[model samples]
Target chain A: MTVQQNVAQATPTINLPTINLQGNHACALGAVAAGCRFYAGYPITPSSEVAERLAKELPKVGGVFLQMEDEIASIAATLGASMGGVKAMTATSGPGFSLKQENLGYGMKAEIPCVVVNVMRGGPSTGMPTRPAQGDLMQARWGTHGDHPVVALTPGSVEEIYQQTARAFALSEKLRIPVIVLFDESLGHLEETITLPDVTEYENTIRKWATGKPEDYKPYKADADGVPPMARPGDGYRVHTTGLIVAEGGFPTQKADVVAPVMKRLLDKIEINNDLVESFEDIDCQDAEVVVVALGIVGRSAKKAVRELRQQGIKAGLFRPITLWPFPTKSFRALTKKAKYFVVAEMNAGQLILEIGAAKVDKQSVSGLNRYDGEPISPSLIKQAVKEVLGHE
Target chain B: MTTSNKKNLEMRFSGAGGQGLQLCAKIFSKALIGEGYHVSMSQSYEPTSRGGLSRADIVASGDTPDYPLTTELDVLLILDQAAVNASEGIIRDDATVIIDPRRTKNPPQGNFKVIALPLSETAIKLGSERITNVVATGVIAALSHDIPLDIVEGALKSISPKKFLALNMDALHAGVELARGLKTA
Candidate 1:
């Protein structure tokens, strides 16, 4: 609740006993604090520090850190570890994220709980490995093949990176699905001084495990929360998991009536628990004429630009979505109701802008300021873009 | 030459890869954090191992900055020509720029005070060229009033490898002497 309250305030809170910590290092520490016991990853630029720190830290906590052959094996081993009743995760950048898509999709269908971190970098394929970019916005949502559920959190600061990585584990365990922690390379590598939450006081969320008779156990069956209890390995329950559509009995099914409800439950679970999935930050959105929407580092830039614009008598505000996937549409609409125009600023060449356009209400104008040249969008650029949007009006 | 409030002060350490540019920023960050100032450090580099442009920037403030990356630099350290062009159009008019004349062919032409020091040469004379980053870190800390030399030395001792501690200390002191000479001249 303290972390959520800090994010809702949307201002950096400086507490005492602060240590200057890098974002990737914070994420690894966060995972350990969240009770993550297994890490399988191949080191990649921008995200390599996450694995590097985990390699050094995980063993101290009695966790297993594996250097896999490649990215695909990394996610597979992570999912396998989670299935063995351990909190597990794997981290990568763009190209490695591409290789893990198949196993990520498999984890989704099999209802395995795990965390996947993709520190965004410039890319169609290995594009500027060390440079920062937010080109993976849409890919994170639709990279896998099919209509699978996604819950991705984008934290904008080093402190938030630590908090959100822990939250990713909690959400994954609660929902029985893979959760992605998305942040740009700038945030991944940026170091800041802040107080981390005490690991002793932190509560770790454990996935629901099956307890009833093994004879009546159905691994694919949904409870009231639309999440079925997973059978722990070596339990007396007959559990079956596959990528194919399955019935409540946990066997493959092609019957329309059986497949329809199964698919519906898979997708509808996210919608049904939107309250748990939706999170965003609203800064000066009330009575504003223009709202700037961004995430990660661009969101931080927009925060500064919006404050400067307010001092200049411009009604500019920032609406940044910390929960990037599922887009947090309801809160975005509710918070920016007074805005007449919206500007979506991102490091990519217009991916999140499309989602913002789709979420707008009637008569609300939306524009985009896109950058894909491996440079971050600065505060001045966002201010200029907001002025241009207002100038046309 | 004068120490000011650490809030909102932007500093950059830039050069080719393998020059330990990020380490320079890390030392400053540790020193500042010890003084109770919040610091945010970010880096940019090419994919190569040792020859492309690399930079690490720090923004120190009373609280966490709204934007962490540098927009206007108060102090700039340039060790190679490859890093010169990347810093153009962003240096403050009153910024202090320290450059190695031996490595940089054409440094930026600006109103900022450009202090051309034999940074690399001084490190080589001390022991090895690899300690050039520690030497440059000392120059920036010595010139800036907000950072105390004792704190910087403490940070260096904590972060340096055990075998190189004495060499690094010598390089740091030589850098302080270089800046002291500039002030007296």
Candidate 2:
């Protein structure tokens, strides 16, 4: 890593307000700031600290925290609590994320507004408990069975963890679907400075539970936004929860007509609002010949690597997806005219590259720069990758 | 190195895992932030407890960083022998490495100047088994030549528990003397 060769003391200013913070604390502060009132999760590495912090901190803010027996039960409890009329969340890593998949599908099926925080560990199955991995990009998007709505946000920094975890909850409640805050194990365990925001700058989502006239209220009845009017259990409303297709009353029904609109509402909310759902970062690609697409810790490396390449006057730029699941296709795809070559760098064997490939039409120019040994891709390695794939190496 | 009236400075405490590196990083960063430096400290370590490497890159810069990536090393404090090898390759040539000479297997060899302080052994001399980091922080503060004595003292003041305050203060000052005694060879 040639420090003097690149990145002179430029863009000097207050960087972001340094405050020593552990990643777990960042997760807690993010969720709390984002309007999370309920947390239900089991303890696990890189992720346990999140739960541990929330256990100690949530009660002070009038929020409820529960330690469930297992990951499945933890998510289920969070789902139930969210529907009971408050913003809810759960945190976990690899094996636990796998356990929560069926229930995650249940969240989509039942349209429960809750946040699931998956601090990814290296895995096929419990591969590395503490090291980071961007391996769960596909899983966060399609881990659950069937067609389901998703709102997944990834934070590259500790500050982003605080900001995005809050956004995750707001997104879940606003869209009335399960939202996932995805951070690699690296980001989860890494500590850094985090500022507790001025409270007023952030907006939080407050779940509106059914009040008055339970008889007329339909739990699944769609409003103008296509989200069902949700009310909690014991709210004197006939609120029923289902994993099966059901009518607005919350009862399971075999009627095909009932299933279509339910599925439609589930999918449409995310689809119609795709523009609002995806988040990204773009640097110096205005007229670049090559664009490097990466996220998480790799995104940080890519940024430094691009800075190096640019110093050599190689016209390199970085495009990081803040929202990994929905894959910011619109923002990235729009740059095809200016970006003739796209180097997709990730810590996986082309998981995110597959999405980038699908989102591009110029197949010849779209290629992958991948690594999956759980070690982070360095700037030098990425620079070499950028040069090799684009014929500069 | 010259200061232009800036009261805050962020430095990174790096070493391999389980040498109490995270605790060391946290104590310093927390101490700095407590002294109002707006500190950002983070550690990245391999998952395993034994033989796995651990690194804490605690940044206590005066200005906040947009991202928590630290490239500038004012003082690179190291404990593990492997850490000396790792830091030697990457850290800035101008940066100072405060080493516990007793622990280093392959001491940094180059034109680079090193302030060798037996911080850990000194902590052992102070009757506690785990104040080498505190003593090292003192050494780093003294050798920093860039940071002020009051700021380092204030950081130590902010972090030490009330009962052990005087002892730590002595250890810290001891490190300063040790740093002053080192001659560039």
Question: Quick one: best DockQ, which candidate?
Answer: 1
In model 1, the Cα lDDT at residue A241 comes to: 73
Query: Against the unseen true structure, what C-alpha lDDT does each candidate score?
Result: 0.89, 0.74
Q: What are the per-residue Cα lDDT tens digits for candidate 1 across A156-223?
A: 99988888888788889989999999999999999887788544322347889999899999888889
Clashes of each: 1, 14
State the lDDT at B174 in candidate 2.
80
Q: Each model's DockQ?
A: 0.87, 0.36
Cα RMSD (angstroms) for every candidate in the order listed? 3.2, 5.2
Question: What's model 1's interface RMSD, roughly to a tenth of an angstrom?
Answer: 0.6
Candidate 2: list runs displaced more than 4 Å.
Answer: A1-18, A198-204, A207-216, A254-258, B1-18, B27-39, B46-52, B60-67, B70-74, B108-111, B183-185
* Tens digits of lDDT, candidate 2, B31-150: 566555556665667767754566777656555543354555666777767676555555566667677778776677755567666788888999874777778877777776555777
**Model 2, C-alpha of B176: deviation from truth (Å):** 1.0
Model 1 residue A49 CA deviation (Å) reads 1.2
> Quick one: best lDDT, which candidate?
1
The clash tally of candidate 1 reads 1
Worst 10 residues of 1 chain B by lDDT: B1-10
